[model samples]
Target: AQTVTQSQPEMSVQEAETVTLSCTYDTSENNYYLFWYKQPPSRQMILVIRQEAYKQQNATENRFSVNFQKAAKSFSLKISDSQLGDTAMYFCAFMKHAGNNNDMRFGAGTRLTVKP
Candidate 1:
């Protein structure tokens, strides 16, 4: 069974600062996908970033980036220039590759607050 772990339960960041959230996982599958999802107070999940196990290069999206360590089964997210809008519950997810199909399992989540 694959499980995602986000050690940090909560975090706070000042506006325009940067924050990094840690995530680790346990999986036996060699090929899979990692994702960081942000669920705002409204409860909509947004894909912050994604990384494939085969890709050594980390993924970045504007203000978000990830450090994906396949060997260690760790995937961490960094949010730069954090703003009030960045405040949300961040969930790390894992998806197994199934012949062009995929299903996701998420961590407990790290609730981030951006203090204005």
Candidate 2:
């Protein structure tokens, strides 16, 4: 079994600034995937970035990047040049890379407010 945790329930960032959302996970499996998903007001879960356990390099998507620490089991999301559209409920998720089980564990979520 795997579990994801988001310590901060809410956060605010100024427009054109940067914000980092923290996430931690616990799992016994050696192979897995870590993800940061952004769900806007419309409630659509959009993938911000993803990281594989075996990959040492962190994943990045434009202004969105991840600080993945495999040893500490930490996968945090960094949003640069925050925009109004970035305001949403961000969720940290985990999934096993192998096996027939396709269950994904999600964090409680962190609601980010990008203020202009």
Candidate 3:
């Protein structure tokens, strides 16, 4: 069975600062994708960043980035220059290499609060 785990239940970051959230997963498949999704008060899930298992380089998008360690099965999200708008429930997700039936699994989530 595949599973994702977010050790932190909540996190806080000052404006313009940086924060890193931890995530780990268990999976047997070698080929897959890892993602970090942020859900705001509106309840919309936004893709923060994604990392491919085959790619050795970590993924980055502006202030959002991911530290993907395939061997350790760890994928952590780093938010730089955090802003108030960044406050949201962040989730780590995993999806195996499937044709159409992509069974994506997510972690419990980490609620991040950005303080001014």
Candidate 4:
């Protein structure tokens, strides 16, 4: 069974600061995908960023980047220049490479508060 784990249940950051959330996973497949999703108070799930196992370069979007450790099966997200708009519940998810179902499983979620 493939499973993703987010060790931190909550995190807080000041506006313009940076914060990194820790995550680890257990999987036997070598070629899969990882992703981070953000759900705001509006209860809408938004895709933050994604990482392909075959990609050597980390994926980054604006102020969001990922530290993907394929060997260690760890994928962490870093948010820079945090803003009040960044305050939301973050979830880490995993999917197998061309597996049966792409049903994404989300973590319990880590509530991130960006204090201005």
TM-scores, in order shown? Answer: 0.96, 0.96, 0.98, 0.95
Per-residue CA lDDT of model 3 for 3-103, tens digit only, reads: 99999999999999999999999999999999999999999999999999999999999999999999999999999999999999999999998887888
- Candidate 3 lDDT at 92 equals 97
Per-model CA lDDT versus the true structure: 0.94, 0.94, 0.96, 0.91
Is candidate 2 or 3 superior in lDDT? 3
Q: Extract clashing residue pairs from model 1.
A: none
Off by over 4 Å in 4: none
Error of 3 at 22 (Å): 0.6
- Judge candidate 3 against the unseen true structure and give its global Cα lDDT, from 0 to 1: 0.96
Model 2: which residue pairs collide?
A: none
Which candidate's TM-score is highest?
3
What is the clash tally of candidate 1?
Answer: 0
Q: For residues 1-116, write the lDDT of model 1, one tens digit per residue.
A: 88899999999999999999999999899888999999999999998899989999999999999998888889999999999999999999999987878878899999999999
- Over 32-63, each residue of candidate 2 has an lDDT whose tens digit, in order, gives 99999999999989988999899999998999
Q: Sorted by lDDT, highest first, which candidate order results?
A: 3, 2, 1, 4
Give one digit per residue, the lDDT tens place, for model 4 in 16-37.
9999987888888877889999
Q: Residue 36 error for model 2, in Å?
A: 0.7
